[model samples]
Target: MAYRHPDRETIKRILEETDTIAVVGLSDKPDRTSHMVSAAMQAKGYRIVPVNPNADTILGEKCYKSLKDIPFPVDLVNVFRRSEYCADVAREAAEIGAKTLWLQLGIVSEEAAEIAEAAGMNVIMDRCIKVEDSILLPEGKTNR
Candidate 1:
């Protein structure tokens, strides 16, 4: 079955409600898209947890090797990995009881969406989180 993303209002609500975002594949390199996006989100007051096995820290946040390795709760799992790897991510997100599974711009996987949705996780595919936040909440969401 084809996967459909949530509506604009729901997306806005997700942003408004989300506090901590676990960024999968977040790179330590400043030039990387993942790092840029995560940094933007962090600047917007969202807690960004860098999930990368290769990095000890990024943007001053300790990096976790995997979702399960995160000791705290994750509001959303923002994935920067390739589409082929997202299903595994979705499963890990579910395992960690993440509320949402978001695949970044230009990446989509129906399998990943299915797994996450079945686990009661809100699934957003092929969308940039920072772009959506800037568009939907121009004033920015209050983490308070």
Candidate 2:
């Protein structure tokens, strides 16, 4: 059977319950979408973990070289990497016991999604978390 993302209500629940987000391929450059989106999430009180090998810090958080390097438990693995690299990120997120794997807008990898689902991780693909959060939990109100 084909895979389907969680329903709108489920997505809202995930957003409300999740606190920490590990962003893979996060860049220090402010112009990048990854940086901008992460910044927005941070403003909403979500802890952002930068996972990039080239950077030491981003958005005032220490950058981890990989998902496995994060010291604390990650509630969500928000990937900014390309679709080709997502499977690896999914594996790492699963290995580290992440509760969710979120692929940014324009990124969709069936293999990665399957891997994450098999590991009991919720998967969100081709959608922006910040947008979802805003739409689903506008002004701190759960639009359920």
Best by TM-score: 1
Q: Give the TM-score of candidate 2.
A: 0.96
* Local distance difference test scores for all models: 0.95, 0.93
RMSD of each: 0.8, 2.2
In candidate 2, clashing pairs total: 0
Worst 10 residues of 2 by lDDT: 135-144
**Steric clash pairs (candidate 1):** none
- Model 1 C-alpha lDDT per residue in residues 1-144, reported as the tens digit of each score: 688889999999999999999999999999999999999999888999999999899999999999999999999999999999999999999999999999999999999999999999999999999999999998887646
Tens-digit lDDT string for candidate 2 (1-144): 467879999999899889899999898999999999999999888899999999999999999998888889999999998999999999999999999999999999999999999999999999999999999987763323
Which runs of model 2 end up more than 4 angstroms from their true locations? 141-144
Best by lDDT: 1
Clashing pairs in 2: none
Q: Using Cα atoms with residue i matched to residue i, what is each candidate's TM-score against the true structure?
A: 0.98, 0.96
Tally clashing residue pairs in candidate 1.
0
